[model samples]
Target: MRHVLLSLGILLILTVSSLTAQVPRRSFLFKDARGELAQARARGEMDVLLVIASMPDQNEQVAQAIAGLGGTVQFQADEVDYIRARVPVDGVEELVSHSAVHSVDISITGSRAFGMAADAPVLPNSEDFSASGILSEAVNPDTIIWPPVLSDYPITNRYSPLFDIRASEFLDSNPTYDGRGVKIAMIDMNPDPLLPELQVATDLDGQPIRKIGVYGTAQDLEEEDDGRWIRMEDMVTAADGQFTYGDNTYVAPKDGTFRIALFHEARDSLATFGGSLENDVNRDGNPEGSSRLFGVLWDEETDDVWVDTNQDLSFADQTALTDYNDRPEFGVFGTDDPDTPIRESVAFGIQIAQEKKLIALNLGSASHATLVVGAALANRGSEGRFDGVAPGAQLISIAEGGSAYGQIESPLISIRDHGAEVVYFEQSSNITRNYLLRDGRLVPTVIYERLIDRYDPVILSPTHNYPILGGIDDFVMARGLIGINGHESKENFFINHGVRVEHDDNLLITGGYGPMGNGALKPDVISPSNYVSTALGFIEGRA
Candidate 1:
């Protein structure tokens, strides 16, 4: 009797709701724009706008109209029928009034999507377990937790088991899908090529994965130093002419020849001195040398350390690293400018190695790139433990110019030409909180959609790290884009009942919200990110 009354009441409400339904009303704004673009007119401001044309023929007319409004076309993609330009915010309505303009959206300003928390440290393991492959149970090393904490330093290529990527389980289920032979392109700031984790000795199929192509300045490693900076005061010589500092022992080159590098802190974060290890120390203009170990040689004259910048084995001919002011014409401290300023802190690192190098050069600026790439394809670490999501995929690195805008087109084209099956670009518009323009369009979304239709590569983008904003980043708002959100894991430190405990799985507070402004479900998936212990190629300030 109660159920019947409820059903009758629900039917009555539904019939009344249907009878009183409101008619759909047309929007007051232009078909091509959102309210924000329209509101810009009242403020008399300027903004970067991505204008898409209805037809290819009107591209020229659109360009002319932009020029007439004292606007400059920053990027023109005639092939795609779009142009990105900076026009007066007040003049947006005039530009939209043109018959050929199909849609007007906000342009993106790029920001690296990576960040690091210095307060939380990932420590090394107490023992090296016997493990050698991606499928091995001991792949992620067991960390030490006694004596309060063992060491704060992160281990290179040490993938944390707590931040489970489920690669082993997924591989076990399929057995054949390890991204073998797939070309995965990464476009970020410079990544260290010689990092052992990035290199492949032998993959799961007994094949060696390799970089098919590398774009941008041919990876001028010669200009880049090879090792991390070691403070001069920390160098202590052992009986065998080996250098020992803290827990690190650096063996000298077996052949007695060494290339010493002295780096001074500089004003603009540029190294005071750096040169390719490939320099012909024999003065033969050839790349053959018998140096194995890099050692620090104290200079008596300048009371400062010196580098063999002149390629002579002897340190006599080199000037004091502090004498950059006198060598203005000679490109001091790796800078072509004559006026590079030096800071008080001076550090040095070994640049040449006959066998295996010691500490790898840590590009602190490139940490973001390292994190993203490590999450994707870092091979098993030196211990033969730990593996990335797809350790068998062939890598192609496309470095981008350091700018917020107007630099990614070349990299995109390069990746497309290389036949990349997966493309991961480590950039997001964190500053521009707007995920969907009022008209429900993101510039990257449109561009990526066209690229997907033409080339067919899986694109992965991050839901920006602001959950309060309640939407994914602009790039991930559209179809065919995988928006990844961050989730917490057991590895992250937390306090529970007056004791430190590893937190369980939960959506990271740093993660963005879903169900986008247009009512579309966003953040296609979530991944562990609170603290992922992966490959950190270089050790910084170890002494």
Candidate 2:
């Protein structure tokens, strides 16, 4: 009897509910709300109105309008207001004609007046709403605790590693030259201070290797000189024929040959001294002898260092020297001249190398103007172009957009006039956009080719998919140095370029990614670049 009664009651309730179901529920309709917003915006009734409703339905109309106006809608809410939208404000009348709005208000975005009028506050948290709070609380614990991982791998080929050395049978005979004392001038937008490996080499005892002079932007020229220069000369004479290194002891060559290192600020001083190595001999009236400037050293502690000697020192002898400047410059381009200051630095560097009678000059900063001028003159016609493949054997660099070809050539000519035999133009810049008319044939101007022919320059053009890094194609073409950055792609490029392309053993290359894998090309030589930390100025860091 109870079961029958319950069944009858359930049937009666169902019938009543079915009849009542004919009436719609009194809930907010999304379409209706959206229509209302459209009408308000169309009527120009809202100054800063944002529709904060569900996606798909609520945002559909607004999105359409924004799209038609050539504006983009970002999904992220954190920075919605900060984003500027270029909209057709002139079409306000057509927008106000839409009908689904209940009210419209006009006010500045984020203004108290706008918020108060809308019965809300500026910068309202989405969590402030009950519905949003409930959703937040209902999130799955696992989703919150362990968010999906985002890849953080560094982009491949952010930098190029290079190996450099002088052309000596002893150094060239070996498969790998350790770059023990070869000075490499690095011209870049900025150099980091933490890169210790980029600086002078240490003695076998692992102490910081000091040089004769350290130069760059931050260094202050010394007002006083210790007897170090005199002592070094004395030691050189005492050693009879060979150079020796000891605690605070640098021996000059016994044959009246003196080696001194110059860099950044020191380059300026050397140029000012007319390319002569300045050292008080016998506390005499003036410094004497045209010291042979050989190499350029760049490091985090010291911006730049140049080394030179009077006698033809072997590569090993030059490598054994260290920077001894108390106040070392600390940047790539250093000068007080506001206009063309950096260019002046390069000019000064070249002048000093010339005066010192260096066999090879390592210059930082490559100016396209210099290369272009050389090319234009060599080709004789605007349509024809030429370039240098190690023009005069001086290493030059082009880093960043500030590079100017016109500004850099005079210095290059100066270096060439000196004993510099091979010049490497590293770094690329803007080339002529026009097509070259050659024998009535319209050909794209080969900027690099022209430059090479003009300067008779040796060029290193690395074409890696990675930005700011060189690729394998660059290494395959030449017998000179190779620079590799840390990246599997770049490492592979370096390896292939070194092993398969150039069989020369004296190749010097540096950077992270030491040899790994079956076909990996072990670095024939390595020097600090990316891994070596160094101080950087604001612009340098950006570069």
Candidate 3:
């Protein structure tokens, strides 16, 4: 019996050892890294390359693999393992299975490759060979910048000069609206306690303004300073349940001409960074507020604006203030404000333009219908909105609006019917594909070309697929009818397409996509969209 037990114990020990040994420890390498990379790019997947080598023999195998893969090889002594080519999706598993491969890592190539600031570490095993799991540790401008502001106005001195020239020429003979005394409505997640340095307060006649009322839940006022606290109170009383004042009066600053009645809805109670005001404020133990800005009432009173602000501003009052054929109105659309239905918001804008008799309307909205409707209203004027490129020009959007082509067509048709002077369409390639279908073609139709020839409508479509820039930037550039690529980063590609570094801005072979002027010198110049800090929403106690 003792002898049998001893034999069983030995067998158990052997089984355990074999199990550990069977766990693959060595990394493998692929001979053709470039081929794999190309394959991944073709498939539109993230590229991952695995290298398996020890400190002693880094050069020989790494060099051979890179050369074999038809790619340039650079070596760092600090990196002891084998160097592997980063190939996109399909080829990753095949590369991992290669006899020479030890482990795989990802590297982005193409135009974004030169600009990448950091490198990824090598994975220890095939099980950890998840291209999707790999995350970029690098910080991007968008990451550092919050509350993106649209400062790329063609007339602005800071950014593009060509656009500035065009704007000056257009506004020279035209009557200036000045947005003075114009009541502009803005729906935001929260109000910035600090009024922006660039905040304009002029009335239509170019007067100054003061005392902008802001309203939110009672909890929204916690920790707010004295000024913000008073503002919040006034705002709530003006819009909240069953509250009425004879006439909501506001004092405009000398340079400020308009009174802004801002309304916010506390969707949740959470105080963290997002959601309704009813949710926890800190997401810690503290209770806080979450609210979203719904809509703004410009110079008119429409049922939509009234419903959003819960005020009796009325369309007639708006019409009395401004003439649609004489003044210009502008709209700025935000990508994050999903709560507000873009269609209703845009319809409200059209109504405001019609009532106010404004010369031009500049609107920004998220959904496709908003862009379409906004364009239609802008086209209503005889002299058009601006009398320049968009002469009688009206609607300008950041992108073509939603993902579907049908949605885009709705706005396009609206622009045509309304006799829009010009309209700018901005979108990423992926967004465009979603709109233009896989097999669809975008040949220039006669009417479309005629509009382009007459109005010079600019479409800023980044062939590179990514969300580096927000929708507002697109609209600003489009309005000026200036074509330019804004921000380019390898991380954006990784975030959008799994294939790392396969294609980049540099890949625009015809200089149409490169640093220099690409696509008929369309992107006339570059503007800064980095580290920009702007007001997000109003915090109760914060200013």
The TM-score, computed over Cα atoms with residue i paired to residue i, of candidate 2 is 0.23
lDDT of 3 by residue, 1-543 (tens): 999999999999998775333113224322233444555577775534333332233446545555555444332222223332333355455544445443342322222221223456875665434566554446355665433333322322222221422455555566453223322211111222212222223334544332121112111122211111112112222332223223443211112112234433332321222322222221122224423432233323322222222123332222222221122221222222434221112211222323322212112212222222221121112221211222121222211221222223322433433333333333323222221111111211112232333434343333233443221211111222344444433444454344467443322221123221111223554422211122222222111
Candidate No. with top TM-score: 1
TM-score for each candidate, following the candidate numbering: 0.52, 0.23, 0.28
lDDT for each candidate structure: 0.46, 0.27, 0.29
Q: After superposing candidate 1, which stretches have Cα over 4 Å from the reference?
A: 1-61, 64-74, 85-93, 104-165, 170-176, 201-206, 217-365, 381-385, 399-411, 435-439, 467-471, 491-503, 531-543
lDDT of 2 at 405: 24
The better candidate by TM-score, 1 or 2, is 1
lDDT of 1 by residue, 1-543 (tens): 999999999999998875333212112223224544544455565664443432334677888888888887865666545666777775666776677665455432233122222255766453444444235454453553322322333344343432367666767788557566777777664444434456653445657745323323111122223233333433333345454433445543222333343432221223211222223211223334533223344432333434543323434444433221122111111212222221111122222221322222222224455556666776653532345676667665544433323223533554455677788756534423543442234444445555665677887766664546564566665456677777755444441123354556667654566666566666777876644423323223210
Model 2 sits at a Cα RMSD from the real structure of: 30.4
> Which regions in candidate 2 have their CA more than 4 angstroms from the true location?
1-176, 180-187, 190-195, 201-403, 406-428, 432-457, 463-487, 490-543
Ranked by lDDT, the better of candidates 1 and 3 is 1
**Error in Å for residue 464 of model 2:** 9.1
Q: Order the numbered candidates by TM-score, best leading.
A: 1, 3, 2
The sequence of per-residue lDDT tens digits that candidate 2 reaches over residues 394-445 is 1222122211121122113322332222332323222110111111010001
Query: Residue 505 CA error for candidate 1 (Å)?
Result: 1.8
